[model samples]
Target: MSAGDISLVAGTAGAEVVAVAYRSTTHGEVHATVNGGHFALWFPGDELRDGATEGVQLEATFRDGSTATAVLTLT
Candidate 1:
């Protein structure tokens, strides 16, 4: 089993982020979001790779109108 968390800082207003998303190389993508200054995301066993691994990618957009990404790997 694997688990992890991500923290983001929303520097200004209109700062929004997609905190977590799930997808497979074969399938498409699943979208999730969080508002405000910070968020925590978790991925359970089998969610990352059909019981092989667990991980999450977090996407963020700043109020300055810039975008960024952070990745967390769990084991």
Candidate 2:
């Protein structure tokens, strides 16, 4: 799946989500950062491994002196 098809759905605005980051838990250790909205990640000459799980962590700082995080697992 391309990064463009990946998305994070969060609640209404309390914090402005600036970006989403991803890291692969396999060899080559690929990392990606995408815009807060829908986006795509493409690695030329390498297909995203099947069954290669990725850990996704989100960082958000709220206007109310609060912080939030969302963790996601991708297969």
Best-fitting candidate, scored by TM-score: 1
Reference-based TM-score, model 1: 0.37
lDDT of 2 by residue, 1-75 (tens): 553433332333222444433344333433234344433333443334332365455454444556566664445
Quote each prediction's TM-score: 0.37, 0.29
Model 2 ranges with Cα > 4 A deviation: 1-52, 73-75
TM-score of 2: 0.29
Off by over 4 Å in 1: 1-27, 40-45, 49-55
Q: Which 10-residue span in candidate 1 carries the lowest summed lDDT?
A: 5-14
lDDT string for model 1 (1-75, tens) is 135533222222233543444453434554444556444433333345422243445455555566676655544
Q: Tell me model 2's lDDT, rounded to 2 decimals.
A: 0.41
Best by lDDT: 1
Give the local distance difference test score of model 1: 0.43
For model 2, give the 10-residue run with minimal summed lDDT: 6-15
